[model samples]
Target chain A: MIDVQHLTKRYGRVTAVDDVSFRVEKGEILGFLGPNGAGKTTTMRVLTGYMPPTEGRALVAGHDILEAPLEAKRRTGYLPETPPLYPEMTVRDYLMFVATINGLASAERRRRVETAMERTRVADMASRHCGKLSKGYRQRVGLAQAILHNPDVLILDEPTAGLDPKQIHETRDLIKSLGGDHTVILSTHILPEVAQTCSRVVIINKGRVVAIDTPENLTARLRGAETMFVQVDSAGADATPVIAAVPGVTGVTIAARRDEQASYEVASERGHDIRRQLAAAIVTQGWGLLELRPLRMSLEEIFLQLTTEENAGGAEVPRA
Target chain B: MRNVLAIARRELRSSFASPVAYVAVGLFALVFGYFFYATLVFFAERSLQATQFGMGGPMNVNQMMIRPLMLNVSVIVLFFLPMLTMRAFAEEKRSGTFELLLTRPLTDWQIVTGKFLGAMAMYSLMLLVSLVSILLLFLLGNPEWRQVATSYLGLLLMGGCFVALGLFFSSLTRSQLVAGVLTFSALLLLWVINWTADSAGPVMRAVVQALSITDHFDDFSRGVVDTRHLVYYLSFIGFGLFLTARAIDSERWKG
Candidate 1:
């Protein structure tokens, strides 16, 4: 478990991470979402014992990060934005060095090194120098180093920033596999990735956490009314007013148009299955209901709404 | 202690893994050999250096044998110590690995001590290799073994102090070249001040000579281990290390 209370970091007149506080339960994978230049990195650094917070206390695994730094650090693994690699050392050697610093026994160290390499799928390139590897492979090696000690808490900042699509998928799978055993806190601005991989998400904007909850819950909370996206065979017919005229339809907007087809997103009053109603209404109108599905809120929309609402100082009214 | 050793071992390995280690040792050997040979020829011409005035003047055989050797060693170190220490923290910062290191279980002091010791170990190895010349000198001409040992000891201690300073300077910058130049310049200024104090007046020279590294080394060059001089050198090294740790801690706070 990680507990941070009233955490703050100030640089001269500017505050980087300002009076922020959050907690991570054991075996929970918490996604830290924020825009660029936000205090995500600073907050992670403080929790990892890289720096002390100016005005707050952090407890990681029952040990204070400031008062018992070593104990706190011993149980944590960190991967910064850039993979902190010694260019001259090979991937194998780097992991070994990290293992030694993590206080692994010799026999256990060797085993852990191999295991980390295997887990991150960098075993094939174990003998390659880290300096010569591609950015994607370097990220993998960084992940390997972070997991080398089997740390109870893992803090990764922008872990998949420079990876190819295939590598990103594999890295997500790796982080997901670590969820049940290690408390993982990963910070990234890529919202969809968080929706796909994280069990709980924490949205931070301007050095403060604006929202924290399960991804589903956050999306659900942000949605004020039921919404559905319906595609029909229009053949040059306008579907916006027809969709709005459906029973329980509160609002209608033309989302897109293609050859012989038009798609409309319809919002209905609360406690309404607008999908079935819209499909029935389209069918009765002699329009072929091509596709009708509930309008699920994407992580990007939730992120922008929450951050903007926090800045505006108004109660965030989750609107569909 | 284990963590310290782990960092030390990695640092030493990195030193040798790069070309800097070889270049430093190779240049040191080349320069030291040139000086030793030139001094031997000069000694033969001057009838084995019958007399040479030190700071107090009127030196003995051991002083004559050891003073020249230590002076040459010190001069060589003025050029080489920076190479050993310039990359201590500067390279880590430049490569963005300093943050990686700080997040580990090791404390700031441990990291500083580890890097310092790593540089010292490499330097001592070079000195050990250079000592082959001392053995060769003994074989060729019967030099005083006691004076030679004391002079080497003094060189080692002085080298340690310079390493500390270089490490501290390295922590202050991200550019290794800048760190290297600054370290060399700092040592050269000390040497210049030491010599200038000799030709100048009493009061100002007293202060200058007190700060001179050569002054503390004179007794060791003459086979006398003054506890005061040893204490001074040790304290200088300690002060440098302390500042290095504090500098690293301060960066974390500000970063």
Candidate 2:
């Protein structure tokens, strides 16, 4: 478990993390979504006990990060933005060294290091020097190092940043698997990663926490207009007019068309659910209602909306 | 202690993995070997001359040969020991491994002391080179072995002071070159402080001479382990390590 209360970090004249507070329950994967220079790394640094916060405090596994930093650090694993690999050390030796410093028993170190290497999928390059590893491998090796000791908490900054699409997928799966065993706080600018892997999302911008919620709720909460996708088999006839005839239908546009089947994106009132009405109307008009589904706003759109609103307002704005 | 040893091992391994160790030890051995042979030949000639003239009995080997040899070694170490510690903290900071280290469960003292030991290990290898020449002196001639041992202890203590000072400088910057230059400048200043003492006021002269890093070694090489000199070298080392810890601690607040 991890708890951060009123955390603030400043570097001279610039405040990197401003009065941000959040809690991560045991076995939960919290996605930290933020743009570059948004204090994501700074917050992670504070949580990992790499540095003390300028104000407030953080607790990891029930230990305060500042007052009992060693205890907190002992229970937490950190993957900095840079991988922190020694160029001269072989990957195995590097992980072994990390294991030692993390306070693993001598007997546990070898097994843990091997397991970490295998889990991060860097086993094949075990003997290669870290300096010779590719960017993706370097990031994986960094991850391997973080989880090597099997710490209770893992703070990963941009864990999937340098990986290719396939590697990203594998990493996300690995992180998802790590959930329910290790509390994870991973920061990234990638929106889909949060939507796909995280149980909850924290959107941070300009040193402030803009929004925090589940990806689904974040998308649904920001949805002002209810939109639906309707595919109608019109049999050579246009079905747009008939759909428009339905009450509460504010607008309709053909999203795509293929031969006798066409899909229309229909917008209705914010609180309206016109699926039943639209489906019945199409059926009564002797048209086949093939498919109907609601389209929630994507996390990408919601993130942009929240961050831009926070930037434009630059003051506390009421949120529902 | 295990934590300290682990970090120390990493430092030593990294130094050996790079060309720095080879280059440093190579240059030190070359210079020290030259010093050894020159001192040996000079002492051998003087001893032969004294015996040939029947001016006195055999020249005292410890005074005439081994003491000067150890003195020259301490001077050569001043030139080379900085290379061993120049990268101790600076390289870790530059490579972002400082994050890895500071975030670990180890305390700042453990990290600092570990690095100190690592540099000392490298320094010991250079000292070992000088030892080989001293051993060759024993194999071929007679010298006070106890005096040689004390001289080595002196060199070890003096090297510890240099190493700790270099670590403090390295902690202040992310540039190895800057660390090396600052350490050399500081060591050189202390090395010559005794020479500068002659021009100072009488009261100031004693303090300046006592402060010279080399001045303490004179007693050790002469086969004396004066606790006064012991306290000075130790306090010098302790102060350097203490400052390094403070520098590392202040980084958190600044960040």
Candidate 3:
């Protein structure tokens, strides 16, 4: 539903978004993951028709963002980083104004505003002024404004930035519930949010896209070897050599030791399962196998690895 | 047109929601009331003096009271209209609602015109309060209602020019204070442009005097509805709004 082709935005001497290209399919929740100043917000701004890209083009529902901005903007809903709220207006009035501008008729505007407020769980604060609401309520009101018209595409920048943990979780759930109906592109520096809510993830850094894939796929693609953590109760027996000698075990290192129990992190050849063989070996060596678990790489590790590795590369690198 | 009206309605609502609108209108009414009273008292004194000299028949209240009162209203708008227009775009930019407005399906022209009309509505409201003060004159004296009506038309036109100029300046900055100050300065410059006509040659003098907004307003205050003055005020409004539209368009590129 959204296509961005080689979109480049520059601010005089500095390029904010450098030849960025990405596509968001209908009903797909794409997580835009990046560190600070990673051109995430800039890309969102361009896609929303809030600003024209310095180069390239973007389309929303087949409408060119620059050439047919009104049509493009009509099909897209944007929640900027700051929420774009009039503090003096009540929540209901703000949503009604958004609904009106989004081209809803009076009856539909009323129906949609109520539904939106209900969906965002902001119904109780409908009459309350936005300025008097807390940060969490304000964020919810912002979300309500974005989804009020039920546009085909939703562009949210840091939707869960300032909320507390509970509010973040609720927001993530709300976003997840929005999937399969509204195509969403939400940017955030939070890694777990992508894992929990986003179907696919785009990791950008320094004005360039470094990686784009599912969270699980990204972790799996970046995994170098199969790693397993094993805790064995051995009576002072040197278990490292024996464990390393097992078939398909490339390396073994003791990670922790507590009395007779020693934990080892074992690395096996790619696609190899050495747990059974290692357990048999430990039993034969008169050591009790207390625990055994595979160490799957987490999204946080993959994110840090990709972003920091690119930063360490000393130049712009497009991994996609 | 619907979009424009929607935006205008919201802007008008927001203006009233803030204290700025009330303070601006109240300050305008108070200052304008004082000026109207002072002018009325001065006109009464001059009329009494004229009657003592057997010149009462020659003393026109329209010229003595309504004309100067319209001029004073113009000056009052020059000072206070910026307060109404300063937050039109500057506050939106400051609070980040500019993004919301632009991301909607509305055109730049719609947004600019809506905001201009919204500010003009507030200006009209301020003028309405002063009108109530003027109506008091009709109750106590036999003032020429037609002349009063023409002077009001002049005030409205001049106020429209002020609002357009203020909107343009507001679009140029994110600081409301800067927008207010710049608008006041720009209006002051236009108001005093005719002052330099005295030192210029004949051709240059006409050009400078023509650019003076007050010079165009003079015809309306005199009950002379010249098409030339109407065209000038309309063109002035169009130019200011055109510049404001261009300013907002440039922001899209700069963003």
Question: In terms of TM-score, which candidate is strongest?
Answer: 3
Tens digit of lDDT per residue, candidate 3, span A1-320? 99999999999989999999989999999999988999999999999998889999999989999899999998988889998899999999999888988899997889999999999899999999999999889888999999988889999999998899988988999999898999999999888899989999999988999988998888777776888989999987769999999999877888889888899988888788888899999999988999999987787777777777834322221222
User: Candidate 3 — which pairs collide?
Assistant: none
- Model 2, position B43: C-alpha lDDT score: 86
How much lDDT does candidate 3 score?
A: 0.88
DockQ of 1: 0.76
- Stretches off by above 4 angstroms in model 2 are A228-245, A251-266, A275-295, A311-320, B52-58
Q: Give candidate 3 misplaced runs (Cα > 4 Å).
A: A311-320, B55-57
Off by over 4 Å in 1: A234-241, A257-261, A309-320, B48-61, B199-201
Best by lDDT: 2
Predicted model with the maximum DockQ: 3
Question: What's the DockQ for every one of the candidates?
Answer: 0.76, 0.78, 0.88
- Model 1: per-residue lDDT, tens digit, A97-171? 999888899989889999999999999999998899999999999999998999999999999999999999999
Q: Write the per-residue lDDT of candidate 1 for residues B1-255, one digit (tens) a residue.
A: 777887888898898788988988888888888887777666554553444422334434355554776787787887889989999999999998898889898989889998988998899888988888778877876778888888889989999989999999999999999999999999888777877886889998888987887678878888889998899899999999999999999888887
